[model samples]
Each structure stands twice: as structure tokens, then as C-alpha cells.
Target chain A: MAMTEMRKDDDTALDLFFAEARQSAPEPSAVFLGRILAQAEGVQAGFCATPVQPAVRRGVRAGGLGMLLALLGGWGGIGGMATAAVAGVWIGFAGSDTVAQVAGYAMTTETATASALLADGDILALAAE
Target chain B: MALDALDDVSDETLLVLYGNGDRAAARMLTLRMGPLAFRVAQRMLGDRAEAEDLAQEALLRLWKIAPEWRTGEAKVTTWLYRVVTNLATDRLRRRRGIGLDEAPELPDGAASAVEQMIDGDRAAALEAALAQLPARQRQAVVLRHLEGLSNPEISAAMEIGVEAVESLTARGKRALAAILAGRREELGYGHD
Candidate 1:
């Protein structure tokens, strides 16, 4: 029992020291606090100053022609459609006789032109007048 | 937010505000946590300059982490305590060869007015004894006794179980008592 009391006494003594230590806890200098605050401000400034770049909405906003090209499967598809259109115009203007001539069949352009002029005699009359 | 309005704000709230780039919150958090970080660093490292450096580094990390700080996930003080202890432990490990006799002398201006109010000799004696302890024991004892952190808080700060904290503190107190036994009369604790 006496030994336990002695231990208690030692504990009490240590507690006093601990108390003193707490009371005497160090205070950081103003310079130290200022430095910390400065660092915080610098970091906060970094957060504010950086701008979040808006995502570039590429290809979707291209106007009417761009939309049309896109609908036609872009440049490659548009090029194919353009070629088909040119060929159709050529076939419509040159007629079947011209196509047959190009295929090495004997055909005259004058005969085809004369027949077209006869079918549209009003155009020939207008030219004569 | 106004600086005056932040007086009643919680640390986590202040951190969130600081994350949002609120200058008032930054000031408030620095004022609240800077001294705490320094005090614990000083206790653990026993050098004012070194303590200030460690405390600054810890607070810098806190600022850097502000944007990602998850409120309600952990207490701010607990995190700071853990960081300061870890940094001090790393420093102590690197300083393994340095003897206690080589401990830096306290500068003449190092003692503050509050330190003067206490028995400076007693505080010094206690500090010397604390310096003699193993790093973990000293950390446990200082946090438990001097800093008044509860076992669970110490456990969180030290990243150990509560039972382990209790064991460390018990052992630390016994060791401190043994180290300071001969100095009781010198420290005017002879009557006790």
C-alpha cells in the first residue's frame, strides 16, 4: 500500500511538471505567423487567378455548308456526289448519240442537233427573227 | 466573408471557404492553426527555428490541400497534429547520431511572457526529461499530458490504436518520473 502511495506521489509530481509545461507552451512569433499567412495568400491567389478554359466545341458549329458536307459524309462523300452530278449533266446535254459515238459507234452530232432543233422550232424561229 | 464573421466558423468550414479562395477564411485558418502547429513542433523537435520551419511546411501543405479538403471526413486539428508529428519524426530519425548534450540552446528571446509566468526552471527540467525519452514516447506524453489531447485524439494523430496510445502514455509517464526523480528537490517538488 505504501508503494502504491509512493507511485501516486510520483504521478502527482509529474503532473505538476506537465502543468508547468502547458502553461509555458511556446507562442509563435509574429514574423512566423506573417510568413504563414503570406504563403496562404499566395496559394489562394493561385486558385483565383487560374482560368478554366472552356471546352472547344469543334466541328459541330460549322454553318450551313459545313452541315451539308457533314450530312454527305464529309469531303470524300461530297467529292463522289460532285462527280456523279457532273457526269449526269454531261449525259443530259450530249445525248445518247454522243454517248454511242464515244463508245466507237458511228454517230453524227449534226443529225442529233438537227432533230433537237426541229423538236424546238420556236427557238429556231426566234433566232431567225 | 468578413474576418469578424469567421470567429464562430469551424476549421473545416474555414478550410472549405479557403478552398473557394476566400481571403478572410485564409487569415482565420492561419491565425487559428499556426500557433498550434508551432507549439507541437517545438515540443517534439525542441528547437525554435527548426520547429518554426516544420510548422510552416505543415501549414503550407494544409493550404495546398485546402481545395481537396473533405469536410466531415476528419477534424482539421487532428490532421495538423498528425502531419506535425510525422514531420518531426522524420527529422528525429535523420538526427539519430546527435546526442542530447548537442541539443540546441534556447535563445535569450525564445522565452515568452507566459513562459516567464511559470517556474521556468521546472519547465526546462521537464523539457530536458522529455528530450531524453524515445521519440514515440515523448510524442505520446506531450500530446497526452501537456497538450491535453485525449487518448483517441492521440491515437488518431499517431495513427495507432487507443490501447496503444494508453500504453505509450503510461510508459512515457513512468519514464519521465524516473528521469525527473533526482531533480524533484531542485525543481521544488521535494515537499510533494
Candidate 2:
């Protein structure tokens, strides 16, 4: 048919155009290629500069002390616990008399005055009345 | 590995090596894929400068993805083609109001004077007609005929169904045939 032949001719014409287009495909300039390569190198360098570190595993394998520390919330918790232990040990070594003296010094003025009154027999007179 | 030594190496292997911090692999991939990305971008966007920028951006994306590139998965060329076409489409969308007359002429820089005159005329004529097509048609035609991508490959690149790709290419070729029918003799194809 004439229509079929005409279609075939059109296909051939289009094919030639496509071939010419392919032959004349635009190429990147050397400078453009260089810039791309440099960017690649830079990106690769970034990966090298910041290697991913393995995650730190936790739990019993960290040892009993470490586990306790972790449970108590790390170094900050350990500091608070150490301070309390040291205070307890100091109080035990200081004896009850020393503790009483320190407690007396820490008492309010009203309590101190009441203690003085009891020591001076004021409490005994009030008791007789 | 040396650059030449990577001649037999697959793109996936090159990407893996690049991921492992091999500079030579990076160079090899750049050498091999950069032109492909550029050519596609150039055909999609008729401006040399815009095409160059788009190509660079696409390849930069490739570099960033190199570390996470999974071997034995998608081909690198397929990924690059998708990136270039998508980016070019976005740019074309932004230039919606611009007329076809505003498109900068593609340069004829590679050939000698006489050869350049003849081939450049044919290339320019085809490119001008290509620019007249709807964005999707131009993309389909360029990828199929010019880039020689198969329907399945173009389907993947354009993220469309294979049947849709077939339809677009068929329509595109017909449109191109009509556009260029008047110029066959001038382009040395002789009158129909």
C-alpha cells in the first residue's frame, strides 16, 4: 500500500536524524570532567576522614563494677555515691561524742538557750512549781 | 587498582571499591559515567551550561551514594540516567513560561569547519525540533533513539510502565518525523 511505503520512508528519514544526533552527541569538556573527578575525590576523602566507629556494647560483659556504674548512671552517680561513703566512714571514725558536739554546734539558738536553762536548774524550779 | 586495570571491572564492582576508599576506582567511574550523564543531560536540556551543571550534580550524587551502593542490585547507568532525567525535568518545569525561542543554541565545537557545518546543521535541526516536543516525549525519544536505551531500561529511568514508554516513543517518533519531513533534502536524506 502507498500508506505503508510512505510510513517506511518516514521511518528511514527519522532514523537518519537519530544517527546524526548520536554522531553529534555533546561531550563534556576536559575542565568539566576534571571538576567531577575532583568532587568524587573530595567525597571519597570525606568517607575516609570520618570512618564509622563500631558501637560500644553494654551490659554484663562490661564487668560487675561497670554494670553497677551503668545502673547507677555512670561517673556522675559514682561521684555522689563515693562522697556519701566517705562521709559515712568519717562519721563512724569520729565517735558519738564528736558527733554530739557537732550536732550541738548546729542547733538553733532557741534549742541552745533551752539546754542552758536545763543545765542551770531552771528546769528543776519549773518542775517544782 | 590502576585505571586501565579497571577496564574489565563492572560498574557495581567499581562502586564497591570506591566505597572501600579506592581513589583509582573513583577515577574510573568518573571517566566512564561522567560522559554518559552529561550526554543525557545535554539532550534533555538543550543548554550546554545547564547540562554541564546538571551532569556534575548528578555525578556528585553518585559519589555520595557510592558508600551505600549495594552490589548486584540496580545498574549504575540506570541510576544515573534516572537522576539526570529527573533533575532535567525539574529544571524544565521551573522554566515553564519560557518560550522555545529562548533556548540557547547548542554549540558545534568538536568537528572541523566543513564537517562541523554539515553535521552541525543536521544536529541543530533535530535538536530544535526535539525542543518543540512536550518534555516527556522529548525525554522518551532522546533516551530511546539517541541514547539507545531499551524500552524496559527507559521505563526504569523514567519511572513509567513499559507500555507507557512504548506509547511515548511511538508518538514522539511520529511527531519528529512530521517536524523533520520538510527538511530531509536539506539534511542530505533526499526527498521522500
Candidate 3:
């Protein structure tokens, strides 16, 4: 029992010592506080200087592209788009097999028409035959 | 809130305000957490100058992270303690161990709220004994006794298991007792 009492006393003493020490803790001087506060302001200013603007800019560009795609998709489905692209390619090519084939077809039709007209013009020959 | 009204705000709130560029919040945090970081660094390092530097460095790091400060992630002071712990550990690694005589005891001859409640030499002796403890044991004892941190809080700061914290504290107290028991009479702790 006496030993237990002694232990309790020691505990109390240690507690008292710690409590006292805590109360005596030193604080930062005014100069130190001033310097650190200044540093904080500088840092905050650097951080606040449009830090999120990059993400905002990126979002805006993405939104613009998305709108353009939506409009294009609304105007033409995939098959219609493919047809328009082929027609456009045919019209645009100044020197290509596609252009040569179109020209050749038009010439052949014209030559056939001329031949038929000449045959019709042979009225005497037909009479003789 | 105004600058003068920052006393009522919590550390995390103050950090948020600081993040938002309120100089008042910075002042409030410096006034509040500065002393905590300083005292712990001083106790661990046994050098007031280096302690002040460490405290300032720790708080500066805190300020830098303020913009990313996540509320309820952890208490501001707990984070500060961990910073100080790492800073002091780095410092201790760079220097040889200085004995109890070098331990930063309380300022000589100034009465404080708790100083009046306890005998002064006994407290000084306790600091000396605490200095004699191994670094980890000393940290556990200081956090548990002087700072009055819970074991879980200590575990977080020390980055150890709760059981490990308990064991360290127990061992630290035993070491302190062995070191101080012989001088109980001389230190005026003999009445008990």
C-alpha cells in the first residue's frame, strides 16, 4: 500500500512537471511572424494568379469541338456523309481516273447522238435500199 | 471574419482562410500552431535556435500546402507535429547526440501558470531525464505526457502501431524512473 502511494505520488509529480513545462513554452517573436506572413502572402498571390484558367481553357476548347461534331452528325448520318465525300472527291479531282471516266462517258454519248443524226440524214440512201 | 476575430477559428478553418488569401488567417495560424511546433522541435532537438528554424520551416511547408488543404483529412496540429517529427529526425541524424546537460530546460527564473503548481528543480530534472531516453522513447513520452496526446494520435505522428506506442511510453517512463529515482531526495521529490 505504501509502495502504491509512492507510485501515485511519482505520477502526480511527473504530471505536474509536464504541465508546468507546457505553460512555459516559448513563442515566436514579431519579426519571425512578420517574415512568415509575408511569405504566405507571396505564395498565395502566386497561387491565385489564374491557376485554374488552364483547365477552364481546355474545357472551352473541348466544348467547341463537341458542338461542331454534333452539328455535323445531325446534318449527315454516316452513309450520307460517305456519299457526299465521294461526290466532292469526284468534282475536286482535276487529274484522276474518276474524272477521266466521267469525261469518257459524256464523249461516247455525244458521238452516238451524232452518228444517229447522220443516219437519219441519209434519206436518199434509205429510199434506194 | 475580421483579423481580430481569428481567435475563435480552428486551425483547419484558418488554413482554408489563408488559402483564400486572408492574412488574418496566416497570423492566426502562426500564433496558434507556431508555439506547438516550436516547443516540440525544441524538446526533441535540445536547441532553441534550430528548433525555431525547424518550426518556421514546418509552418512554411504548411502554408505552401494550404491551397491543397483538404478539410477533415487530418487535424492541422497533427500534421504539424508529424512535420516537426520528421524535421527533427533529419536534424538528429546530421548531428551527434548531446547529453542531458544540453537539454533545453525551461527558461531560468520566470514564474508560469504551471510553474507555481510544481517544484521547479524537479521539473528541470525531469527534462534532463527525458533527454537521456532514446529518441523514440523520448518522443513517445513527450507526446504522451507533455503534449497529452492519445496513443492513437502518437501512433500517427510516430508512424507506429498503437501497441508499439504503448510499449515505448511504458519503457520511457521506466527509464525516467530509474534515472530520477536516485536523485529523488536531492531533487526535492522525496516526500512521497
TM-score of each: 0.73, 0.73, 0.66
lDDT of 1 by residue, B26-87 (tens): 99999999999999999998899999999999999999999999878889999999999888
- Model 1 chain B: weakest 10-residue lDDT segment is B105-114
True contacts kept of each: 0.90, 0.87, 0.50
TM-scores of chain B alone in all candidate structures, in the order given: 0.87, 0.85, 0.83
Model 2 TM-score is 0.73
**How many clashes show up in model 1?**
0
What are the per-residue Cα lDDT tens digits for candidate 3 across B129-177? 6656666777888889888899999988888899999998977776666
Top candidate (DockQ): 2
Instruction: Give the fraction of true interface contacts kept by model 3.
Output: 0.50
Clashing pairs in 1: none
Residue B14, model 2, lDDT: 94
Model 1: lDDT of residue B137: 78
List the candidates ranked by lDDT, beginning with the highest. Answer: 1, 2, 3
Residue B138 lDDT in model 3?
Answer: 79
Clashing pairs in 2: none
Off by over 4 Å in 1: A52-129, B97-120
